[model samples]
Target: ANRLLKALFLVKYVDTFKATPRNLTVLVYDRFGLDLTGLGKQVQEALNLLEAQSYVQRNGNVYEYLTNEEQEIEKEIKAVDVDSAEVSSKLFRYLSSDILKTNKLKYAKNGQDFSFGYKLDDVPQGNQRELTIHFITPETSYSDSEIAAQSMGRDELRVFLGRDKRLLADLRLLLKTERYTKQRTNSGATPSMQAILQSKQVLNADREKELIERLRQAVGKAQLIINAAEIPSSSQDAVTRVSDGFQELVSRTHTNLGLLGGKVYPEQQVAGAVQSETGLFDAATLSALNSPGTEMESWIITQTGLGEKVTIKKIVDRFETKPYGWDLGSIEVVLGWLVGNGKVALSVDSNPVVRTEVTDLIRNTGKHPHVVVAPQKAYDHAKVAAFKKFCTDFFDEGAVPSDPTELARFGKDKLAARRDELNALVSSSRYPFVSQLAGVVALLDEVVGKQVDWYLTDFNKADELLEAKEDLIDPIKSFLNGQQAKIFDETQALLNTNAGNLGYLPTGSADTVKALLADANAFRGNKMNQLKTAADTLRGQIDDIVTDKRAEVTAAIDDRRAEILGSTYYANATPAAQESAIRRIDSILARLGGETQAALILQTGATFEQDDYPELLSRLVEAQQGGDDDAPPPKPMVSVKSISVPDASGVLESQADVDTYLAKYRAALVATLNDGKRITL
Candidate 1:
């Protein structure tokens, strides 16, 4: 529209694009060959009005056409905006990619060496070494000045996780399972697919979920190796151990995927490999792809919910004659069209069957237990909500067929079959309330599409006759239940009046009141509670069964739930997944109290299973020794992490903390090739 308008406006002067540059202004009268002199202020007034609208803007002596970005916001609000229901629904389906999550990494980033910050008693046995704790700091480049230990100048001013802590984490490691969700783009599937692929491209390989998961697993078993080292021979050794910790982690990670002959077989390759949460969460936050589930469901779930399996028919005949209400013919036509499109499926069975026969299913670890794919990340909250609303309101369920031949055929073929019974019911005083049902439908149409301008501007008899089938059916169900309740009450009253009905017992005895035949089977003393307890116990056994069977449960559980959990897949299962989760729990618990580790854990819940407890000694560590207690410790370690980018496909230590990573990455990428170094990019 903008392009067409611009082209039409340009044709007024009949000049070349080169002559009429974008910023140049042209008088409307000269281009259209219309005179403004006779019109006086009227012509100029209208042009000025157009200028205020921002479709065109005024320059020194001319009008400049505005780009789309420069256009003024639309002032006219439509009645039925539906506020993004269509887009939001899509986001919910693919929530994992769009959803954001944060996880804690263990241990604070302490540098290679530092002055002992506190008394000898302050050091915990966790990272052991008694300290003389003299601090030496670099006051200037090339000068390692021995100042008073714990000097408070330039070096001391820095604080690792202050308010300005870096949020630039490796996204792949940050959000696994979590996805950035956005509404489906209005442009259709091609662009959407392209965007998804682009997202995949942008994801850094090292930060993938599978890689991080492997590191987490390896770290779980490998950290115990560090426990074996009795002392740090040098400060650098401590740093080296932390760096090596990452590799030790990678080498040792155990996966739910089976290892054949102590190695992963090609067939055992899994899509379930643990990736880095650090990278993923950050990326998810930035991109707003967190709502993977919503995106998938808006388009896909409709097939299941509105398919041929669901059949709609009027229960009563009288309702058909009501103005604009659905008749038996209308229902048949809608159902037939739906079936033709494969939108509905007919099934005698209550549940649908799934087919899942395959090999090489994805499972680097067993089904990740913690999270679902995000529907939409919080980043695009407003947009996703708006799109979802649009889908619900604007999507036409295809146009209704109105040919005379088809209508007559539907009346004969479908309605005639049920005519006798429907007629009899209609004649009866208790004919079902279909008119009441139709009104509810109209209300819902307005509600779901309140923002849609068409709904507000128009009204029709068909709208009044539409029915919210689910809502109408609910009251019918409730009324039937009420009748059933009355039947029970009447039976009870009759039982209470007769002694012979009470098994020939004494009239006043409690036993006489307990009618064996009339009472509900569940009324036995304490049996309700006893049965509930049994049900709970059975449920627990099911959970336990899953835990126990995790070992041979090497196959990934990526299949739809209805397909798995059958007799076949669990033919010989073991506790492999449960054990893995338990091991992770233990590993996380072990790293408790380390500042950096705690920070990561607090955000992520627990990356690894931890098992340590706090002691009273922890209280003593923070105790002040003198007055004006702002005094600093003799020496303290500052946690550090590093990543060095080289010209070649360089290596990175996965375990390095932010500082070390920043230091190395900056040094490698700081200068340009023109400055004597090849650019890291």
Candidate 2:
């Protein structure tokens, strides 16, 4: 018990002075006059016992002294080192003040008496004698108190008696009862005992109460408070009484008034104990908290704005765990306050109600609920404004916009209008006529080609315009088809008429040949190049018929020539007659050489006879018996003389001789003629 007191005294000494002036053993030996042989072991034992009691904890070689307040089963107050000069000085000043003093003062210099609130006339004379010593009241000291509680343990330290009761009690006693050593002295020597002059007189109940009230007021001004309930009722011996009662209360061992900032622990439970992670209680609590169907479930989604409802349990679960570290009940209270103040809107149907009915009923329902922080309206307005701005810019820039909205608004109508205009332009006649086709091509280039690029991105508009342009083809096609059909029908009719006329041309109709030739000339003269698709075909058919007819006519004319040349009369006739016949055939050929129908007419007119004349009448004297005509014999031939002339010029020399020869020649001729016989001259 004495050792415990010594340890407490040593700790108190170090705490009060902020320095240790001597070693433990030497200090104990000097103060208590103990033998030093085994003092080290005794001191160590005492320190160990103090540590076991949690009165002083050793950190390495340094010891931290715990106050009686820190030794509580539930609450603990650490013995905070008072290294702050301000705190220490302030404590010193308070303890030295008049409230703690129980002493008196008498003072004077020279013949004047020292007085309170002295006037100038009461000033001491110069170089006066020393102030006289005055008797002071005796007071209890903290060492005596410590000795009084020598047998006490933790309970003795529980009640705090301020710095004056703990450390400055001896000083207070010294100031209260001390007196000057010399009877007469100079002012310089008298100043050594000035503490006695500053000492407070014994405080009466009213004075103590007034001082405490002032102290309380000062503490309040400083944002501090004293626990007056811890103060004992006894005035004369209040410290001892409070200390004893606190010790007795602690000794019961079952009462657990928790320490500051800590929960009330069970009796006999050690402080700062470690618990298992998978302990039944903790595991069960975690299981309940983490369960999917539990009330805490989906709370994360709610508070994080991932889901709709913001319930109290969700708020608590979101904040009161992991990073936030708030207690559940504290979060509940905060949410309750918010709901009451209408900062948050909550659903009433939640299992555990968040706020009271009165508070919820008083909330304004007309205003929008502050659910999730968002800017939906602002975003929508901005989007529309941007769209409008883009549209305005697009038009103002002289560019066509191909956005869907722009296309829907303007492109479709523009295309439709363009289509209507094109329809009107081409409606009068077929487009792409030989004369107007170039202009149509230019229009298409200027209109569709220039504007199609703008609507390229808006495919529907492009397709509509393209469809309109495609519609332009139908009219030209229809016109060409009609023209082609007309040309085909006309050509077929011409071919049929010419063929029918040429078919009968073998009958030698001149008009048929003339009309056929006229039609051929017309067909050849009319250029079918400008005609549409069927023109070449019609021309080819007409040309084929003309060629065939010419061939037929040429063959017929050749046959007529052969027939005329091969005739018996032509063969037996004079050259003149044959020449006339040839001239006539040549004339016919010249008239219709290439004219097949005319030549066919000539060929048709000429015919070859089977026989030139019918057989002459039949011969009557066909058969006669041999020698039946013997009685019709003719007379014998008569003899006649003939004159002979020599050959050449010498033979007939004279004219008379020649005359006689002539007469003879005549006579012989007559004789030969009369006798029906040949005469030689």
Candidate of highest lDDT: 2
lDDT of each: 0.28, 0.35
- What is candidate 2's lDDT per residue for 1-681, written digit by digit as tens? 255445555665365432121255454564565656677677667665776666654332334455553343101112222233333333334422433231112211111111111001112222232121110111223343443343242221122233332123223222222222111122442453333223212212223344344433332222101111222334334323322333333323212111111122221111111111224224433232222212232343344465455434445445433333333333333333333322343333321122223223222222114322111111233443343344344223344432323322354345345445444655553222323333444444443433322332323233333443344334334444555435534544554545544453334433332343333122222323233223344345445655665556557656645754675434555566566556655665565545534334434333211111110000001111232465543222222222243332346778987887777667656655676443211
- Per-residue lDDT for 521-597 in model 1, tens only? 32324433444443344334433433333321212111211222242322222345323433543444344323222
Worst 10 residues of 2 by lDDT: 612-621
Alpha carbon lDDT of residue 78, candidate 2?
25
Q: What is the Cα-based lDDT of residue 498 in candidate 1?
A: 37
Best by TM-score: 2
Error of 2 at 272 (Å): 65
